[model samples]
Target: MDKKLAAEHLLQDVSHYHGPMIRQMKQLVDIYIKLAELETRREDTNRKVALPREIRSVKQLELVPVVTATIPVDRSCQYNEGSFPFFRGLSDSVTVMNGINAPKVVECFGSDGQKYKQLAKSGNDDLRQDAVMEQFFGLVNTFLHNNRDTWKRRLAVRTYKVIPFTPSAGVLEWVDGTIPLGDYLIGSSRSEGAHGRYGIGNWKYPKCREHMSSAKDKRKAFVDVCTNFRPVMHYFFLEKFLQPADWFVKRLAYTRSVAASSMESIFTFDDIYPLSA
Candidate 1:
């Protein structure tokens, strides 16, 4: 009885502080308490097992019971469950992103007078895999940051919050003042205006375009080219460079340095770097 009283006091003290760990502990406590009540109810018919008045009164702190079923058995369940976490406070005005897909940039206002933005997209591809990779990269970055000896340079992987609404749709945290890497590469190549920014006036592009245009069956020709891609890729590397070879070598090095740092984090693994392809 004394041990139980001491444990309850310790729990109360810990509950005063809030964080992810605290919330997890609270969830475990709630589960245990429910189980204890159930056992007590089964033991004696006359016994009335109830939660403490303090625990019952803290409605906001209580965690809602999770539905284990894949499909909801109750149609009248609250809409907030498994729905977009934020929508009621979203602003009406939305801006379109500059890209082929043209995702929407949505804005929302928080109760604390803070503004949040998300890039919302609806497409056939599921972004859950992207989210998982982002999270994994984040964990790797965290390790690198903590261990300064392993990596001297301060390089952190860029990641954004991803919330998947469904299998085919999702929203990502908006990152401002950034353009696609492909666009940057093209813009750099055409900085002097000697060639089209998107290879419009490039001699190789025109030759390739003419070949496709003059083909008796355009779709079949494209399919054939794609089917045998090695020769096309070889030709591209040999003759279709938008920029000088030195410029490409430098870019390749830059990309490798970032990847190498991440690989170094797991260097202890026997197969971290394969000797042969």
Candidate 2:
């Protein structure tokens, strides 16, 4: 009951644009995915109609990008010093990413004759706190790296630039080629139906009961089975790996490493003792 309430409370401030943003992102990705398929088909169609090598290269070079949307007149995007100071303006090719918040992948031009891809996100309760947390984590990672007592690989903490445009909005340096851990665990796209979120429905083994049709019923079922939550969570663990025992062994080692790093980061900082102790 408490957990369900907390989840609702957290999502209370979800922006009205959240749904549109997700739809836009999906639409954009779908367009690109279809375009890629069409390109493959075109290549097959042109297989027999081969041109000269030089002509082929020229044709490829002639494929200039077209701007589909009108550029915004408000070209100026201000950022604090040391955070993309050379950033000049936004490009027309804005990509909405898949998520509840629906972040945008914006192309920014720099004065140094280069382009950068930054993630522009809005509809946050407070992004300033997120920026602060990132900065503090970076500091902790630096401390761990400098200390010889830390792991051999050091704290492989990835830090990127975060510029808060407002209390509830910000631009983050885009990290390419990343997958969500939740997606990794699921091994594919989320399941179908309204209550298809991870660990929400009934597990596969020893089929306890049918999955509730409505979201409210699903939530109620999940909450009622909280006492036997281990089996429910274990279902996901098994889903992630074929061999449960082997997965458990590896998970323990990974958990220990993460826990040690967390402890070291907190205890090493003298400022944390007063608050934590």
Candidate 3:
């Protein structure tokens, strides 16, 4: 009994204070993952049971009742009983102090207010350092907020240029020889400036509306465009999912002839290099 009590106390402290999971399913959770096909063609699936509460402490470990389970409409339940371990997700709360993520040790300021003041008062050297951190954190926050529905939505790329590194992706984003990415992509037929059609194979530039909506808009507004373009591609820029590195590697050090790299400051990835193909 003492052993069980001790274990229960230790787990209670850890799970209560540092339990990994965004919000304990205040309600019961029923998760089902389809497994690989069995050798006999039977629909055998591995189980990943994420039980809500601690199983060992419950009465009669052999029989714990499920309070509730959330099953999406697109689910097909066909798995054996399984138990999942506890996992903690990350935290989003931040307290900025003088444009810095604060240590509970000292609190003078927070959020964006501290950021602006620090930028205004810092020396040339310090300004350069702090500004970079602030921008990185800003990007992270944006990515998290924008990805709230990542479970049901995906960032599918219609074009290959959006990938982090590829010579073809960069080659496509130039004026001297603009690869004409729009030569095949599409937009709302009503929007005059919206290019609704690119070349044949490249037609999938905007794979899906959801993905396109989450991606940075590259279309420029041409004059005589339809004024009522609520769904037009020109209205939004989704740089959150598209990281700065999606443009080019700092050094390109692996080349046979090219040598030395100079990414002196935070330049838009789109500016230095183009998206991958």
- Which candidate number would show the highest TM-score if scored against the true structure? 2
lDDT of each residue in 1-277, candidate 3, tens digit only:
8978997797677677545421243211211000000011112112122222332122211112221111233345332233311212111211221212111111112211221111012112233333344345445434534775631233211111111111111001111222232321242232122333212222232344434455465342221122222233322222212444632232121221121111212234544586575
In order, what is each prediction's RMSD in angstroms? 18.8, 16.2, 23.7
Which sections of candidate 2 miss by over 4 Å? 1-85, 112-114, 187-189, 192-261, 264-277
Q: For model 1, what is the alpha-carbon lDDT of residue 67?
A: 15
Number of the predicted model whose lDDT against the real structure is largest: 1
State each candidate's clash count: 0, 0, 18
- Give candidate 2's error at residue 203 in angstroms: 2.6
Q: What lDDT would each prediction earn against the true structure? A: 0.49, 0.48, 0.25
Q: Please, what is the TM-score per model?
A: 0.42, 0.44, 0.15
The lDDT of model 1 is 0.49
What overall lDDT, based on C-alpha atoms, would model 2 receive against the true structure? 0.48
Of 2 and 3, the candidate ahead on TM-score is: 2
TM-score of 2: 0.44
lDDT by residue (116-152, candidate 2, tens digit) is 6766566644667667766777777777778886656
